[model samples]
Target chain A: MKSETVSTLLVEAASLLAIGMVFVFLFLALLIAAINLIAAFCRKFPGNFPAESSSVPLTKPLATPSRKIDDTTLAVIGAAVHQYRKQHQSNVKD
Target chain B: MDKFDVLWQSTALAHFTLGQMAMMLVGLLLLYLAIVKKFEPLLLLPIGFGALLTNIPLAGFSQAGGILFYIYEVGIDTGVFPLLIFMGVGAMTDFGALIANPRMLLLGAAAQFGIFATLFGAIALNWVPGFSFSLQDASAIAIIGGADGPTAIFLASKLAPELLGAIAVAAYSYMALVPIIQPPIMKALTTPEERKIEMEQLREVSQREKIIFPIAVLLLTILFLPAATPLVGMFCLGNLMRECGVVERLNKTAQNELINIVTIFLGLAVGSKLSADKFLTVETLGILALGAIAFGIGTATGVLMAKLMSRVSSRKINPLIGAAGVSAVPMAARVVNKVGLEANPHNFLLMHAMGPNVAGVLGSAVAAGVLLALVG
Candidate 1:
């Protein structure tokens, strides 16, 4: 209500601003240290991380497997088998 | 003659005041900004429409028995809606960038200079005969610098409900203007070389560390600043649900459905505050001016802090990312990235800027806590 109170409040605000900034920096600094520590620990004990088997396992992930036969190739293979079977049946019938 | 009299009485013309008409026009302007300009449309659209509804004379939309009134009573008045939104934000946020480069927290802290600086600015306006801002009023007004709408609304609801309309409007307006407000100051503070600097790529954070991060932050908050528990607590809850990878359902609800519902109610509640009597004051104009100044000062301080850090710290930080420390989330980060690209085509500062962007959220939350503890 008084001018004195108003001035006191402003003074308090200034102090709090300074204190708040320091706390923010300090709190985050601690978090930074914690993060760095965790990173170092993870690097040191990589085995503690989930094994490939425990997580997603891609077998021969980088390896290129032999190309599978195309539809045309499969059709050709089927036609040859059918022709051979038909000729053998004809011979038996003769 | 009696029938004509009843019709005239029923019409808006019979009940409208100059202030109400002006507020209605303002509401339409906000709608135009949201729909056509795509400025924070999710919020401004509803807020604008709510303003329109509230300004209608015969419709008791903002009165005791009205839907908007109940929404305000249950949510904004009790400060629940903002907390729910914070939780959603926490769920949606990825703190990995922040965790990987925790030092960006200093930029976040530096950006809050706008808040404290504007406190003095708001109080000093008392010298102008028509304006007088108490400490509580000043605290509520200054948080517009935080650039987080929910935090501003939360603090205003707690400290100064009367100014909620102007404060919320100013906060969101400045947040939407981040693309325009931050760049020139960011450019002025740093050399072209500093803007062009490329930061190192962040390390991959572990799932374990990600899961633990929110819990650790909550523990720290409880130990030091319990007043912030309402905001930080809900935020951490959302973040933990997201990171834990166990509560997919709860996380989905928090970040998406739950948040969407709360946003609608929150917008309308805020709009209800934009009544003709409340928003038509000289103080509202002062708030708008102070809000812009706060954002500019915040942008300037963040860049300066980065420049200071660059000299002392061994690691190189592109000062452009410092502007993202104002906590407008991905928008501020994108602005930094755009500015960085202009200086050096090869530099992509989005991910780097994100570190400070999220840290700014935490920093502002902490700053709000300090203000609440001291002033509220």
Candidate 2:
């Protein structure tokens, strides 16, 4: 009875292995297909999706100025430049 | 004199057996390995300590009425602990890389060849004298090849609880040894040129894709292999908690406190099974040997699969990432990264290897489900 059981188990194991390999392959193939389909749909309907704000733009395009900088904006820019020079000079000294 | 005799009788010295003494030493060795070598210290340390506690005479810690027994019966026997651990693993896992390039799932699936192949190897061991393994036993033993600790423990608990101690030890030990074991096979199979091939950067996977991924996978698994639902279902629950923004508290608890608490109990329960009669046998040796062969085979097949895929695919794929298909998670991926860097100084394969690494986890769970459906 024991030997018969072992023989049966051995046969079962071989079959299970073959079945397992095929099952894994088929399941993963389906997953791959699903992912591709989703990706294609996303690409085709890009406007419906949110833009990626987290990524920094590699190069900013220069757009024509809509309006001239006012005196207040110039004053703020001057103050910012002064602060940057002050920090840069201090770091240079250090 | 009666009082003295009573006190003496209560001492472990009065009841110590050679088996208990030997098991105690084994426990100490595990402790040393965990603490000094830092080989899976979090789990191993508790396991080692539990071993020490169980082996002490007069404690009866592993007996039916004992605390360890209750923990084992409630958790390990019913297969709750490993499922809880899976939930935590899922919560911690990030599937962004896997979603970006779904082809990595092939490597994951291929790595499971180790598990199924080891089934035959376990049964083949019956040809040796004084060795006999039933089909259920072989199924439990073969899962060590999956290189997944919780899945191995869960499957072993269900199929062959008697072998749980040896199989768990083998599974975790092999996982820890991924750094040592994977590199040589990775190097032997690939040329320097193949090893140095730089993969293109993975595209950014959207938050929406990430959110839908666990649900989609869970639904697919339930439809095709409902047997896998226990492990995969809990895993998807954890992943959903992580991906969905609303359950931050639940996610943190699953990943941190809940898993930690269950890990302690799980380790103790596994260690309780390390008594000499169970652990010190010819079968233990067979299991260890089969586990090594299984892990080795899995690693080789994963690399081979990648090599085959690289030829068919349009883009270049560094075959080292295929070694991560063994499901040792970040460790296997890290090994691939380290190996890739050695071959080319500028190469970074960490993000790319993660694709196959996470896929290996899901693949192993599916394989476990298959085994359970067949043999359980």
Candidate 3:
């Protein structure tokens, strides 16, 4: 009706929007902080999930076992070791 | 002169002259970039073809109720095309990395500073001859900084439909060139040591968090930015289809068929706007220059924010990854990884950089909302 009344309504609407925005910002800031907190926890202790736990035991099997050597192969290894030890002993004595 | 005039008059059925033929060759070059170079082939191919059609003088492709014209009306003019494309992007995007590293949100938000900065650059460009851009038009054109095609198309649809072709072209072109444009700035900003900073392995984001994120973001949009919800809502819808794990059919269709189909229509619609009278102008050059400035500013802001957080966190964050904050998705992330490898062959920042890359997508959509609110 009157210009003053319309202006008053407009002012009220603006204020409402501002207040609404502030609240939205605060809520989002908190939610983001919460997500960051959870992600930080997850990073520190990852295998709490079953999937992450499954990936860990995979690399453990790579440690090869000690095996008995063939006679010829063992003789070659022993001769090479003997030569290496003799050189080390000479160097140490010097 | 008389002989030449007689010969020219004798040349009937000659629809295209030499200059028009050259422009057509330029269109062919763009097509090569699309098909062979794979520079966003889905859009670029259609756009290059449309450019050729529009420049053909008497081609009825741009006339009333023509295919391109109808597509423009149904999609681009109504702003539905970009929104639908956002759905595909959301379905394809992985927010897991950003969720794993929440602090990357800061980088994502910081990257938007360039968007606003270029708005000013666009307005100031009006001081030059043959370039006249209003504030709203400048705001619309400057969104190419996001490097997101749909967002560029979205804003242009609202503020400057006449400028859509240029904005979309700049956005997609720079996107394809992110590998070229970003590395120098990233290298200049950080030392070899900073680039070599090995990021800790990203923690796995849970299925629950992954599923909830899109919903949360959609709710946030509903509350904070209703103007952006049309684009963001469809985006979340597509992401929900993906993350829910039950809608494999919808996810497949949205990501593959629906998106590809819409991209052709959208590109053709946008390309149809590239008539010589509308496109070959000083204003288009201004838009291109402003887009570059927008992209540069967005990149610089991301790096600066990353640097700031590094001090605050007491652990090093690779500032190079921050350059991915311009919404180029995997391309920006790949660029970060590539540049990081140049510094230290050991470092792999692709997955880590993806956090800001995707988050920047959301940030730019939010920026688009702000523009719609302020301008619409």
What's the lDDT for all of these models? Answer: 0.87, 0.90, 0.79
lDDT of 1 at B319: 82
Please provide, for model 1 over A1-94, each residue's C-alpha lDDT reduced to its tens digit, 9 standing for 90 to 100. 4566667767766776687677777766776776667667766765544322213332457876659988998899999999999999999999
In model 1, the Cα lDDT at residue B215 comes to 83
Which residue runs does candidate 1 get wrong by more than 4 Å? A1-9, A40-94
Q: What's the CA RMSD for each of the models?
A: 5.9, 6.1, 10.4
Off by over 4 Å in 2: A1-5, A44-94, B1-4
Each prediction's TM-score versus the true structure: 0.89, 0.89, 0.79
Instruction: Quote fnat for model 3.
Output: 0.05
**lDDT by residue for model 2 over B124-202, one digit each (tens)?**
8887777789889999999998898999999999999999999998888888888899999999999999998998989
For candidate 2, give the lDDT.
Answer: 0.90
What ordering of candidates by lDDT runs from best to worst? 2, 1, 3
Best by DockQ: 2
Model 1, residue pairs in steric clash: none
lDDT of 2 at B67: 89
The 10-residue segment of model 3 chain B with minimum total lDDT is B11-20
Clashes of 3: 0
True contacts kept of each: 0.24, 0.36, 0.05
